[model samples]
Target: MTDTGMTAPEPTAIDETRQRELQILSEDAVLKGHPHGDEQCKNCLYYLDVDEAISYCWHPKLRVLVGQDWYCQWWEEITAEA
Candidate 1:
């Protein structure tokens, strides 16, 4: 995976707009900052691993398809189901 090093969008002065932008931007930062290693989207709780190479991150703010090798700060170990 490639690291884009691109920063999040700057916050505007509007309170509501800034707050929402900050939230999304922070989450984006977390996703980009995650270390590239054994920790990957496939094993994360938020990932819906439907195939080997690609999967969906079900996070509310960051719903998107991620690769097996891609990871983020939001990653959590898969839990056992009852």
Candidate 2:
């Protein structure tokens, strides 16, 4: 392979202990389907849509893949910038 100056960015490493902690907190927070009709992960500020049905939660406390219809207590509505 030719030596290219470009390189892929390194992936962020999450230690096992931290990963476990986050998982526990995620479970405790009841990360699941939306409880209300209007609020869902897709509309949340932390939600990064991967497709029509799935999205990744970018919340610092909850970095995980989530369904578009799923939601959590940390959900915050995305606001438009002025």
Candidate 3:
């Protein structure tokens, strides 16, 4: 994890063949930061909102407390159950 204004850490190496599989899983959860548009982390399946502003996401690579409205490329809409 890194502090604000710091460059993100180098990405973990993954098998190219499993890229799609990994993406699907990563998108299923959400991360913290400024939201990518209206894709708030609070609406994500992996978001654990601690309050109105503070929240945590079950990210595959990063696990840090963040604002509820934060988002990343791995953002995915929360699916509803039938």
Weakest 10 consecutive residues of candidate 3 by summed lDDT: 24-33
User: Model 3, 13-57: lDDT tens per residue?
Assistant: 566546666565446544334677687777666676635577766
- Model 3 error, position 75 (Å): 0.9
Model 2 TM-score relative to the real fold? 0.62
**Best of the two (1, 3) by TM-score:** 1
Model 2, residue 77: C-alpha shift (Å): 0.7
**TM-score of candidate 1 against the unseen true structure:** 0.54
Identify the leading candidate in terms of TM-score: 2
Off by over 4 Å in 3: 1-32
Q: Count of backbone clashes for each model?
A: 0, 0, 1
TM-score between model 3 and native: 0.49
Candidate 2 has an lDDT of 0.77
Off by over 4 Å in 1: 1-29, 33-36
Per-residue lDDT of candidate 1, residues 20-39 (tens digit):
87678567747653446767
- Tens digits of per-residue lDDT, candidate 2, 1-82, equal 8879899775355676777876797797678766456878878888887355887788888787788888888878788961
The C-alpha TM-scores of every prediction are: 0.54, 0.62, 0.49
The alpha-carbon lDDT assigned to residue 64 of candidate 3 equals: 54
